[model samples]
Target: MISVLFAILTALSNGAASVLQRRAALAVPDTQTMRLSLIGHLLRQKVWLAGIGLVIVAAVCQAVALATGPISVVQPIFVIELPATLLLAGFVMRVRVPRGVWYGVAAVTVGLALGMASAAPGGGSTSVHGAVWVPALIVTGIFEAALITGAMSTRGNPRAALLGLAAACGYSLTAALMKDAMGRLDDGGVTALMTSWQLYATAAAGVGALFLLQNALQAGTLVAVQPMLTLGDALISILYGVTLFGEELRTGWWLLPELVALFLIALGCIELARSPLASGHAAPPRRSTRVT
Candidate 1:
């Protein structure tokens, strides 16, 4: 219950930060590309700094959540982020959230609850065997490399979706690394944690994830990016939780409910992604675009 609360807090912070940070980033001039100097300019934006603060808060909440709960439960709760962002953006932009968006949010909420209940018997430890990290790291690295390479080959929305998935993978890895580092604290106090390489790896994975997210935002609109980011992270995190942390989900007959739950989530995410207000869209003037 504590972990769930913290995870929910993290999701809320993340949703708000996504809107504020991405909006602030969009304010930067088109000439700025991927230059490090862009950091200086972004830092000057009050909105970006505020977003960064929220990000830090989210990180802290996430760490606590991971420390206390199975990764399977904690990470999947982040699926609410998309709907939260949608509603928050709607309020911030002073636009009425469409009825369809509310329905989408309901669907996602119900699906997440169903999925969590279905996966209720999941079991995992706070840490994995050191030997497990080797294969896990190698597989994750190769997968992220493939995603970035594929992203580079694509353009527009496709590029955004690929990059978003890459970011999702990186974030999931960061969570795993953090949990492993937290386990170090349990074994040998702060000294063990400070000495652990998992600590450094967590930071590195987090930075990599943020970089990919920024690139994804730059590559395409929120419509193309949000669902991929939301769904990909939840799905990938489950894989990491199960494979690396030994979390187990019920199978056989239970797989049916899980599949249905996932399908509803995917549907909800896609629907929410198309919301004009959440997407920072100007609410398409279709009649005008049609040469009226």
Candidate 2:
């Protein structure tokens, strides 16, 4: 029960962070220019920086939640952020969200919930040393290089999707490294934070990833980019938790349900891609005139 509560809280925090980030992204109108200069403009925006700070806090909370809960339990709950972010955009931020996205949100939420409910619990805990973390970092670097190239080559939504996928992978691996560090922490919390270079590296990577994600969001629709970003992050994190952290299915009986849940998640992503919330300044209407 404690694990369930913490998982929900983590999901909520993540949802709020995504909403704020989206708002900040939408606030920046699209201007065709060199990518490096655009990034500089984004970095200078203090409101957006605050949104990034919120996401950082969410990531930290997620690390703490994973430290205490089974991966199966934690991963599914993270999916809640998808719906929460969309709803926040439509209702709180007063952005126009299409019906297709609402359907996608439904599919993702239900599928992830079913998957979590049916997933097998971890068999046992496992730990790894900091020295073994280098390869993961390299993989992340390669992934970012590929994503930036793709984003530069593609146009419109495709570029955003590619960038979001890259960000998702980076965020996933960073979380995995963070979990590894958490498992190895010493008694003194502050000392543990100071001594672990892996944690600091993971944090830096996450920040870089977020910068990419923000650029993607600014360049594409919320519906197309946000769901893809959230779904990819959830799936990758679960995969890492199981394969890297040694988490497992709760029972043999759960395999089918988990598969079904994943199917639902895929359907959800497709739905979200059909249409997304519009971003950019609303244009002024023409003045009324009498016929002559």
Candidate 3:
């Protein structure tokens, strides 16, 4: 129950952070996309700094949740971040959320409850061998590189979705590494955490994810990016939980409920994407400066 509460807090923090950061990122010149100069510009924005602070808090909450509960359980709860983002955006943008949007949020909440209750994920290994980490990181890195390359070659919604997926991979890997690092901390204290490569790996992955996410936001509308980002993270996190950590979710008859949950989540995402709050945040691209 404590882990569940932490997971909810993580979702809230992450959702709020996304809106704040994206607002700041969109305010920057579009020419700064995928460039280090973008960070420099964002640093000038207080909203972006606040967003970074929330991200750090979210990371801490996520780590505690992963330490106390199975990844499958903790990760799924993060789907709430979508609705949370919409709600936060409504307040920040001063837009009214429609009745339909509220219905979607209710569906998502109820679906998650049903899914978590039915799936009842079980714990597995807290630590993994170096061999496991090596192959997993290699494969995920290759896939993320492919996604980024594809995104760079495109424009608009497609590019945003591809970059969002790449970011999702990075975020998922970061979560896994964070969990491993926390496990090491438990076993060997601060010294273990300092010595573990997982800690460094988590930080690297987190930076990469942030870069990709900022670019994704710059490339297109939240409607195009947010669902892919949320869904991809959840899917990859599930894979990490089951394959790397050896966690288990109920199968057989429970598969039906899982499918229903997925449907509800998808529907909710679609509805949220159509909300006035999300549309209002879809800023127009800044005019480029041309030099003779």
Output the number of the lDDT-best candidate: 1
Per-model TM-score, in order, reads: 0.85, 0.71, 0.82
Instruction: Give candidate 3's total backbone clashes.
Output: 0
Which residue runs does candidate 3 get wrong by more than 4 Å? 18-52, 92-94, 152-154, 281-292
In model 2, state the lDDT of residue 247.
Answer: 75
The alpha-carbon RMSD values of the candidates against the true structure, listed in the order shown, are 4.9, 5.5, 6.5
* Ranking of all predicted structures according to lDDT, beginning with the best and ending with the worst: 1, 3, 2
Error of 3 at 251 (Å): 1.5
Tens digits of per-residue lDDT, candidate 3, 106-173, equal 88888788878788887888877558988887889789889989998999999999998888888888
What are the lDDT figures for the candidates, one per model? 0.87, 0.69, 0.85
lDDT of 1 by residue, 114-212 (tens): 998887746788888769999998999899999999999989999999999999899889888998888787889999989999999999999999999
The TM-score obtained by model 3 is: 0.82
* TM-score winner, 1 or 3: 1
* Clash totals in order: 0, 3, 0
Q: lDDT tens digits, residues 1-292, model 2?
A: 6656777777777667766666666566577255566666668777667768877777667777666765546665776766666666566566567777788888988897787778756643534544555665566578779888988998888888888888787777777766666765544465775687767777787787788888888777665576667667777777767666667766577788888987888788666545444333323345699999
Clashes in model 2: which pairs? 120-249, 120-250, 121-250
